[model samples]
Target: MSKLGIKDIAARSGVSPATVSRTLRNPELVNKDTRKKVMKAVRESGYTPNRFGSSLRTQQSGNIVVMMPDITNQVNAGIIRAIEVEAQKTGYSVLLGDTQGQEARERHYAQMVSSGQADGILLYTHRLPFDLDNLTANLPPLVNGNESIEVEGLNKVMVDNVQGAKDGVNHLVALGHRRIAAVLGDNNAPSNRERLQGFQQALQQAGIEPDEQYLVQGDYTTESGMKAMEALLKLRKRPTAVFCFNDDMAIGAMSVLREYGYAIPGDISIMGFDDIRYASLMNPPLTTIHQPLEEIGQASMRLLLAQLSGKNSAPQHIQLPLQLVVRQSTGPAPESD
Candidate 1:
């Protein structure tokens, strides 16, 4: 929408400049026929808006770098695809950098962006990859996604993990679950920490005392989830219900429960976060919280584009909504723990 002249569109479509502006900026204000005419003219012109202006001193690469923790993750894969689709519509491309949770790999991507190899950045990380001392130095425009960094003036987009977690746990409590547990993912992630906070808050609201022994840690992997569930089963008073930080961990925990001859949602119930595609395909299906993965990717790209076009100078934080997906995995708690 930026950099292209409105007058040319008006002249080609035989409409007034104001009409062209209205059609481009707010198409809903114009009649459908006029809108179609303007769009046809735009298409004939073969115009794709430039994402960045001539603001920086270095040459533009027409590429934006997206540094993610893991590329093989289903959540990350969906997000990356959406980002690429959105970027292509605006005459820009993406340069994906998978950090693999390695600090050195993160730094490598950080240096690539700062060196003018890309026009801007979309970070899916808990913290900035580069050193804090270079915070004020020459870095490309950036927008954070999936997880948040505490740094000032950085735009961010993510779901409310705490509230989401609370809602997931509260679902189990409403079903008469008194002894509930949580399989937490990597605590280093802000999302995981918020989920933990929510888990505690839900229990306190339900008049259930917080028990440190009920909390187990996982690294957001299926193997880690299995390990966490194994530890929980070893407790003398094992929990009647369990909540996992992500769907992958939940799947892992479910497998362990099966191996131990436990009937899901009959003897115990399970809840998970991030309703990935596989969540619904599980044996009993997964009852989990849904994060809008595609929306996160598209929203992050829009945030960076807003900065690149000088439309927004202030940082903006977008907290997307989360949905509670009810499936066969969660049911009324058994009479005995």
Candidate 2:
């Protein structure tokens, strides 16, 4: 029963101690075969590096912080899982911080870099504070996933919200839905604004005038969705179909519609964005725009790792595509009753 050290693993793997350390700290820097050999040797030798000792030697915490606007939202769960897997592969652990959509909390988590608690940060939140430029300047390597900000030297992995919204609206239009209402997210976020603009673009392409009365804003919450539905129902000219900015709101709206004795697709068609896991399990299932949550997570981590390894020179802005998933929630508008 011998305590294994870096030298022991390095000798067993026929590599230098520095190589072993690099392999443990950042495997992406090593060739895949070399990394596999190093890991196998470490496992066989029962070598576990002392995190405290390693941190002291490298002047790094070996921790990454991920900040989510709302952790309870199921849409972020997949991304978190992906990040966890990839971060583990890089010998880094993740600390999750839920900001609850609060600017102060977001700023607090972002400040961890300067405090030396984390080596990097991953932000998946709505619009950051306007002064985020000054904040990001002092932070360690930061990457954005499922959200966008205009800060320089930051990497972003985002889905094409505009195209996704346009596709969602086009599907409704094809199903004979001309009077379409929209339940949009917060107007302050670029993603929400892009979705609204895309929805409007689709209508304009069809020669349909945009109706302000059919639009309502939500905070991307289920309760907001319910309230928006109530408001939309009270409009003088009710829409025949409704498109929600996200699946959470769409599900909320659907519940309210059912409680009001309205038949789904029979009275009004409903569609949502972000095809979360529960979207297909709802009573009637949901028609939604599918975002690659897992892929976004993986890609963001890769980008951050690249930057950390000094292999990536310029900031990268990646926009993944979206798919329209048609389920039982949407259909042709019912004939006038």
Candidate 3:
């Protein structure tokens, strides 16, 4: 039996060999029906294209770099897992770049694309690394995942933070809480900034004025949540409800609440964003706005793949939907004082 090759796939799929090659290299360039046929033929015949030889001929790298601040975070892990799965479907490898919140480290990773080591970049950050500026003459495609950058002309896949926050806060408002507060993460991050805006908007809509003192900054850690909760406790008139930027922060705040002998929901209703796995396993399960991490990653990969295939269009912002998961953490606001 002859070894299956591109020609065999083309013959089996009823397409030219060039079409089979194109579909294998950049599936997005081939029409859906044709791509499907070629893929089916390849699968049935167990034909694996010579990726190394193909890369050399095309002067391309079958690799994509995914940059993120922290890979240890469950949220980041979930998104990257999905991105890898999606990239693998198209014969591309994903290179994980943990920036560790350092500028130099980020620049080092960005150089991979400019140096022809990776085809493109997927970012979970607000700024394109400075090193990429030198490659303006031939910058590879970039797709932002979850986090948003200030630069224009880059596609993004993220949830609507503003709307998600509003929905969470509105839930508290509906529960008759007037003295509401927020434990927000890094204000520099677009998602956190948008969530803060949403919290304010929800308050305004509920006829409650935004209180500056109630808006505390957190670094999106459990420790930051604890400190934010401490600061709120020091206020002359403490808030009856609080919303956290993420579940970890919420867990931090909850721990402080317990230390000070405050009852969850009974004394203060708490809410959070980014429904991580542990959100439901806390002493009192947390109610949070759920960001579809997997879907966001998949969308980001698809956007980058489209650009890599020369499917040009205006930059797209694919905002995925958010769900408000209600659990044991929140309840009706406590009766006045």
Candidate 4:
């Protein structure tokens, strides 16, 4: 059977081809009654609009692309769900792409924007290629979600990492933990840097000097967390408390500590960031900083939609607030200390 054509729907709907095209590309330009009529006629006639041709004419794919460093992380799941919910409300669909934290994979997705396969791109990758500015010049409007990259004119939605980290550390300090260690995510990532700075600031505020020997770096992975814990345990005077950049790493560190016969919150206190779903389910619930993952996702989608709608609004940099959720993982410093 021959494929359905636009002319068939246009003829049946009593609308011109140009009107049908506008209805598909910019539905807002068409009245509600006309759009409903056109949509019904198209659906009744089994008409599938040629998105590729429409994209070529209007420089829009009618689709949004979302790229994240890792898709399996629980935090990322919340973010994706939020973005999808908001995107659906605007008559847009999202194409999720995972780069697995590789520069080449990130660039591949970025190139999709230039090719008109996506109207805009949402990036949650960290340590993106340094040449992002050069690449951005050739792509569609881009937005950062939960991760900041250095690119002028690009909008961003992030949480207050520094303040959150400081709050976590101050909580530990208040619990009488003086010799605190940290398992950090990628040192180069902006969020990690901010968190580390906040930790240092909090220590200084408590009249404690930053101890480099107690700090270990990880890649925000459970395995890396385990390794970092191993290194931290080798310290001459092990920390009485440990702060992790994220829940995954914190959980990893906890596993290692348990293997080494250290009782959580009894031998050493532990804290984490990004209060992921599993944070509250561990043997000893994790104490963590709650980042508004869903809100960040919604905000990023809203920003992209606003740009697509030709709203001449200022580029936005939304910094959502963070909260500290205390639980079983953190307690007063060990009596032995």
What are the root-mean-square deviations of the candidates from the true structure over C-alphas? 7.2, 4.6, 5.6, 2.8
Q: How well is each residue in 1-337 modelled by candidate 2, as lDDT tens digits?
A: 6777888889999999989999987888998999999999988877889777777777788788889977777878889889999999998889888998888888788777777788888888865533654665554787887768766667889989999999999999999888999999977677898899899999999888888889998978899999999998888878999999999999999999999988888888999999999999997899999988889888988888887777757788998999999999999977783
- Name the runs in model 2 displaced over 4 angstroms: 1-47, 127-139
**Model 4: per-residue lDDT, tens digit, 102-157?**
88888788777767778888888864433654755643677887878777677889
> Considering every candidate listed, which one attains the maximal TM-score?
4
Q: How many pairs in model 2 have backbone atoms within 3 A of each other, for residues 3 or more apart or on separate chains, i.e. clashes?
A: 0
Give the Å error, residue 301, model 4: 0.7
Please identify model 4 stretches exceeding 4 Å from their true place: 13-43, 127-139
How do these models rank on lDDT, best leading? 3, 1, 4, 2
Clashing pairs in 3: none
- My TM-score estimates for the predictions, one after another, are 0.82, 0.85, 0.84, 0.90
**Candidate 4: what lDDT?**
0.87
Candidate 3 local lDDT, 1-337, one digit each (tens): 8766788899999999999999987888999999999999999999988766677787789899999999999899999999999999998999999998898888998889878889999999767786555544555688887778766577888799999999998898888889999998976788898998888988998999878999999989889999999999999999998999999899999999999999998888889899998998988999999989889889999999999999989889999989999987888988877
Count: clashes, candidate 3: 0
Q: Which candidate has the top score in lDDT? A: 3
